[model samples]
Target: MLRFKELVLTMQEFFYFALRAFATLPKAKRYWRDVLDQAFICGVESIPIVLVSSISIGALMSMEVGNLLEEFGAKTMLGRSTSNAVLRELGPLLMGLMLSARYGARNGAELGAMQISEQIDALRAFGTDPIAKLVMPRLLAALIMFVPLIALSDFAGLQTGALVAQYYHKLDPGIFWNSIYPRLLPMDFVVSFLKAPVFAIIITLVSSFNGFSARGGTAGVGRSTIKGIVASSGLVLVANFYVSKLVFDIMH
Candidate 1:
């Protein structure tokens, strides 16, 4: 009962806090440039990793499917299984996990450090909307970064899957590509990418908020870091299910 009540309270706080955050966006309009800059840092620079991971994952996933299907003489199904996994799950999840580890940790530490040093307070003293200037950019950056990175990850992962099928799976390269060809479309890519921005916004906002509102000195930073990663990852997984269902339903 206590846990359930706490869950309810958390949900209430989340919705309420989100509402309040939305209302404050107008006040942060002047800081769009800052947000873009942060987006580039948190989102763009993370691209190479996302890309490599995505492609490698693709190849690896294909290999897994190849192994399973080899017994059934259904090696051609490797493409579909691998593609579906990437499009439906791994792509967004991997990207989200990566961001949670990289961006989430950094956001928490940066904000926590600022809070402890009283720099956040100092910003308020200067009549700046710290939430607007600091939090909002991070939020916007997240929104912008998530989708592109996910797309990058998915594409890379698929190619990796193909490579695995080609090499370890002992499948012909041409046949593997041909089988994979029918499984993907431009629209599938779009749908895969679409999930990323949402994941980005959720993580970015949550981590920044967690960091900014954190207390307890040195321990608080560590706690916030863990919380941010957990929250970001949990939300990403949960959100992916709903997003995938909606996208597939619409597409079909």
Candidate 2:
């Protein structure tokens, strides 16, 4: 019962914070410098890992898919199999988990540290809107950055899959392209992109909520970071299921 109550309170905090952040977005241009800075942290700093991991995942998936399809002498299906798995599910899911660890934890820790240091209180005393000045920029940055990151991940995964198919599976590149293009509908791409923004919302809000709610000084910051990542990671999985279902219904 206590656990349920705590969960409810956390959800309330997330929604309340998210609403305020969104409402403040119009005036966000005034915070452009901060937004751009956060964008660099979330988007630019994340690219190297996102690119390497995505391509590696795609290649690994291709080998697994090729092995499965080869059983029935359907090696050409490698492209469709790999692309479908990557785009519809694995790519976004994996990327979200990674961002949850990287960006989500970092956001939580940064804010928690500020709270412990009394910087948030100092800002409040100075008549500054901490949510607007700090949280909102990071939230907006996450939303903007996630789309491009996911797009890059999608492309990298597909291209690496194609390479794996050509080299490891001995499938002709033309056949691979045919398999991918013909099998994947336009909505597949759209749905994948749509998932990114929803996930971005999840990561930023959950992290910020934990940051805002932190207590107990330095130890509290550490705890908040852990709890925030765990919560964000779980929410990402749950959100993915519902978003994918919604996308499937709409596309169909």
Candidate 3:
């Protein structure tokens, strides 16, 4: 009950801050440079890691699913299974987890450090709304970047699966490619990218909340960073289930 209460209160605070951030968008144009900088950091700098992780996931899926299907003389289904898994599950989930660990912790620590060092207070002294200047850019960047990143991850996973099927599984690339499209529907693509925004929201809100709530000093920043990652990742996984369920229902 205590934890649930804390969760509710934190969510309330998040929504409040989010609304203020959104309302301040007219002034956001002045911070366009900051938003772009954040987008580069969160999206561009993240590509290599996302690509590598996605490729590994794809390769693993091909290997495991190929072996399972081969036992039943159904090796041709490898591409279908791997593609579906990547599109429906691994793509968004892995990207969210990666971003939560990388960006979430960094965002929290940066803000927490600012808070502890009185920089946030100084911003207020200058009549700047920290939510607008600080949180809004990060929020906007996360919202904008997650969809493309997930798409890239999905593409990487599918490519790797195809490669693994051709070289490792001794399956024909044409067979793999042909099976992928027939097994996929437009809704699968929609659902894949849809999960990303929710995960992005989780990361932004949880990280910023922890950052804003940081107390003590440098040590507090460290703690907030860890807490932010944990909370954001947990929420991403929980939200994934519900979002996936809703998508499933819609598709049906």
Candidate 4:
């Protein structure tokens, strides 16, 4: 019962924190430079890991799915199968998890440190809205940047998958490309792109909230950072599934 109450209170506080962050969206102009900086950090710094994970997953999926399709004498469907997996599912899903670890961890650790050093308090004492100065910019940056990251991840994954299909599966590049383009649906694109902002929200808010709630000095910073990463990563996975399901249900 005590644990349940604490959970409820935590939820309440988080609701207020997120509300305040969103409420400060109008002040974004005042913090445009911070928004741009955060965008570079989360968007530009995030590309390599996103590419690495998506390319590896795409290659593996193509190889495995190609083999299985070969057994059924349906190997020509490799492009279509791999396309659905990569673009509609794995591509965005993997990007979200990667950003949750990389971007989310960075936000958590940096903000946690600021919280511990009383920098956030100092901002408050100066009559500045800390959420506007700190959290809002991160939120806006993630919101703007995650969409392109997802698009890049989808493109890289499909390209790698095509290469794998042609080389390892002994399939022709023309056939693979042909199969994918004709079968591609607007719904697939919808499902893929929509996950970006959803993931951005989960990662930014959860990490920043954990950071602001940090305590116990240096050790606490580490703890909060880890908690932010873990929580955001888990939420990313959950949001991935639900967003796909919801989109498919409503659109299909």
Is 1 or 2 the stronger prediction by lDDT? 2
Tell how far residue 116 is off in model 2, in angstroms: 0.7
Error of 4 at 251 (Å): 1.3
| TM-score between model 3 and native | 0.95
The clash count for each model shown is 9, 0, 0, 0
lDDT of 4 by residue, 104-159 (tens): 99899999999999999999999999999999999999999999999999899989
User: In model 3, which residue pairs have backbone atoms overlapping below 3 Å?
Assistant: none
Model 3 bad stretches (over 4 Å): 1-8
Candidate 1 lDDT, tens digit per residue, 75-154? Answer: 87777788878886888788887788888888988998888788999999999877777877777677766766776777
Return the top candidate by lDDT.
4
Q: Between prediction 2 and prediction 3, which has the larger TM-score?
A: 2
Give the TM-score of each candidate: 0.87, 0.96, 0.95, 0.99
Please give the CA lDDT of all the candidate structures: 0.78, 0.91, 0.90, 0.94
lDDT per residue for candidate 3 within 1-252, as digits (tens), equals 999999899789878877886787677688999899999989999998899889999999999999999999999888888988999999889999999998998899999999999999999999999998988898889999999999999999999999989999899999999888877898788889889879987898789889999998888999999999998999989888888899889888
Q: What local lDDT score does residue 85 receive in model 3, on the 0 to 100 scale?
A: 93
The RMSD (Cα, Å) of candidate 1 is 2.5
Q: Residue 172 in model 4: shift from native, Å? A: 0.5
Model 3 scores what on Cα lDDT? 0.90
